[model samples]
Target: MHAIIQSLCTLWRPSWQGMVMGELKYRRGGGSGGPYKVAASGRRIVRVSASSEAGERMDLLLFPAAGFAGGARAGEAGAPWHRFSADEVRRYSASLGDHNEIHQSERPIVSGFQIAEAMGALEGDRDFRIRFHYPIRSDEMVSLRKEGKAIYGVTDVLCFIWEAL
Candidate 1:
């Protein structure tokens, strides 16, 4: 087996509780296939701990959550690591005129954009909503592993493709 398959099998143990399978019914574009069209969808999960950020809570961690038609990657996606500093948050708030005192305060906590959903700040704007996940703050760390000196975050990214007529 390939290295990727080996690693995945080692890491993920599929249970019989939840499994799905299907079959393709037919092919499109007639039998000759003038222009074959192929579609691909992918999802990736990344795990980052304070250890990866050099033992700093303020450090940032970046990953390629989405890909574009031109194969463009998310900002800082090439880097396996990033640092989330107060200075960066402050700068972003300043640039965007988000002068909320909570963002400017020197508190040990930052808000999660998901909280906005509970607070009714999120609307139909998905982009803005996701950006909230990045810039917003929380009163307490929402990361898992609340005990000891470690935290973990899990983010989901959705990407798609479209052809113009």
Candidate 2:
């Protein structure tokens, strides 16, 4: 099952990359000028300079899930950790009227929008910029945390950082 899913994701990568590149082109004329620092919770702040390609790549890396393999343990200090099942992913995709193949796979990948929904449910509505590093499989556990102006998604395999809006 994992192999099949991996192959599908591999096949889907080029199209996703093209979409991102297209969006980047569209955004070229709109953003602010050089050297911006994004504040995260606690005392961490990340600096990005618009003048450098490295900074742009770093920014891309910063923004970008799951599972319950640990016997259903509770979140630390009453934190809200969401578990995404195949059914929940289906329902969420249906609710949004999105029929993306990735969201409909046997071990469907949870959408970033759905993660935002979970974040809002836990911490109220707020604007966020999210970057995904991996695909979350069904039955995966996800947790959200707020530090200053950032919200992070914690999963067994990867961590996602969201800039609070």
Candidate 3:
């Protein structure tokens, strides 16, 4: 099971260079139970658990509910803000062949991929595990905050988190 989990982690590791744009540094703690850590460009860190079951159980512990409060604020130091329009969302959705009605509505719903794209372009060099807390509408503003290896997206609320690979 440990080997299976390790293999899965290796396979799932992000290969998108544009998605994470920086040199990767690897560090292995000296113990069988130690988590593997990979840091990227001083902004992102990927933690691989020593075992599969432990890894699964660690998700909630890694990101707690209180972490989403206050979200990312615009104009903060080191936090960059971005905006997307309904037309941009539609075009992006069409480009990806995603024809979801929610994305085409009058108050078009912004796809998560769109948010990932913007985050990837601006942040670069990280694998992201984003949790969508709210649906972003067109013309809404989104701000990104990099707290260590975690990147939070604040779009009127805590919208998503991009965990670096």
Off by over 4 Å in 2: 1-80
Model 1 alpha-carbon drift over 4 Å, by segment? 1-81, 108-152, 155-165
Off by over 4 Å in 3: 1-80
TM-score order, best first, reads 3, 2, 1
lDDT of 1 by residue, 105-148 (tens): 56411322113222222122121112112222323222221123
Candidate 2 per-residue lDDT over residues 47-141, each given as its tens digit: 22122222221122111111222322223422447779999987776666554566777888776556645654565543345655445667877
lDDT of 3: 0.48
- Model 2 clash pairs are 41-147, 41-148, 63-131, 64-131, 64-132, 67-140, 67-141
Q: How many backbone clashes does candidate 1 have?
A: 9
- Residue-wise C-alpha lDDT for candidate 3, range 20-97, written one tens digit per residue: 111111112233332433221211332323233233211211122233345443334335477788888888767655
7 Cα displacement, candidate 3 (Å): 23
Q: Order the candidates by lDDT, highest first — what do you get?
A: 3, 2, 1
**Cα lDDT, all candidates:** 0.24, 0.44, 0.48
Best candidate, TM-score-wise?
3
Residue 24 lDDT in candidate 1: 10
Model 2 has a clash total of 7
Query: Looking at model 1, which ten-residue stretch has the lowest summed lDDT?
Result: 16-25
